[model samples]
Target: MDRPLGPVPAHAALEALLPPTALLVPEPAPPWTAGWDERDENDGFRPDWLQVRRLVRELMPTPKSVTRERMAEAEKECGALGLDGLDGGEGDFATLWTTRTGAWLAEEIFEGLTRLCDVMDLEPRLRDFAEEYVRRGMTVEAARAFMLAQ
Candidate 1:
């Protein structure tokens, strides 16, 4: 009765905060064994980076992400056509996609994706999704299939 209150272990506190099914899942192997290294650089930048981004986002359920992605793509395409004449031009999109700079930007953005982000940069939802995957007994192999099936 005289024992003073004790601090909970950090892990215990985290576990308490998580859903009963929460888990710690490992990252899936990048789908393409070699990665998207051989992007077609001649034509207007293909925006292949968007493909990588899509891959990562779909792996996790961030909700509302689909709409945002659609919107971003629409905006970029619109800009490329210079329909708005404010942000993008066909040439602008072409330059961004077909050059080293564009690839670099795509690589950077792919890493910035919440699911694919560096551990230190992950948002709470992305981190939670990783944990939940483990909790749900998703193995790296299963994750690969899961991603492919989607």
Candidate 2:
């Protein structure tokens, strides 16, 4: 349901500055774009550091030449991701990926499933059958069969 903004007045100015042959396609606005009209002075949500870095990195080839306009676009994208409520902390994709795979055993998997349920506000159940199947080092399909038998 989200849509990016279309070309703006500044884009026209930018196009004029460039060579006539050079293509000047305006970048798409962030998904949850908001206006700064007087009636709604609040610009809208702000993305966290991680989200900003990711968006910018995805758009630009290198981080050295980031412009104010590009930064604004990244911020808007972050808002779309529901990052406004997050505490201001500088984290990147590396941090998230590094922390996600500390455990691989059955106990760890069981614990992770429990945590997932908590986050989703779902009722937790003791998945003993699944745990036993995992402990035996069976393939996922076989484990599922064992679980069904229990």
Candidate 3:
């Protein structure tokens, strides 16, 4: 398992401006979508309210435009998947996507952003942060983290 670049290909990047329309799948609703809100927030569970409002407004950076778009897209995708009118505009979609596909979608978002950074000549940042961590060393864990620093 090798490539022209160190680990990730040169073309791999993130789409920081908009949520990926194609990435949303509308079938077989994620299993964990049920009772997601009832889970203990103290655990590693993705906070359901984080989607509606920033968890720590002062500490957390304002969401990018694409982040907003992603929320809208997730809502629409939910409706398309026969999940319309869920929770009446609360963080229902966020809960669903996060519980069911957050980790997976997060990886996809990270890879997409990496590719986007590459296209925008922001590869240096990716190399310093994401690629190096993924390539050089660290016990790779499936922990959820936002990859893009920009």
User: Per-residue lDDT of 5-81 in model 2, one digit per residue for the tens?
Assistant: 12232123222222222112211112333432222235544334335445556864342344556555655666788
My TM-score estimates for the predictions, one after another, are: 0.18, 0.24, 0.21
Clashes of 1: 4
The candidate, 2 or 3, that scores higher on TM-score is 2
Error of 3 at 36 (Å): 2.7
lDDT of 1 at 120: 36
Ranked by TM-score, top first: 2, 3, 1
> How big is the positional error of residue 109 in model 3, measured in Å on the Cα after superposition?
6.2
lDDT of 2: 0.35
Candidate 1 off by > 4 Å: 1-30, 38-61, 72-150
lDDT of 3 by residue, 1-150 (tens): 012232243224322312333223332133343354555434555333334333212222333332545666656644554444343345455543333333333344455454454445544545444443333222112111324433
Cα lDDT tens digits for candidate 1, 39-108: 3435343344445344434432332233445445644655464444112224333222222222222222
Q: Lowest-scoring 10 consecutive residues by lDDT in candidate 1? A: 1-10
What C-alpha lDDT do the candidate models reach, one value each?
A: 0.34, 0.35, 0.37
Which of the two candidates, 1 or 2, achieves a greater lDDT against the reference? 2
lDDT for residue 28 in candidate 3, whole number 0-100: 18
Better of 1 and 2 by TM-score: 2
Give candidate 2's TM-score. Answer: 0.24
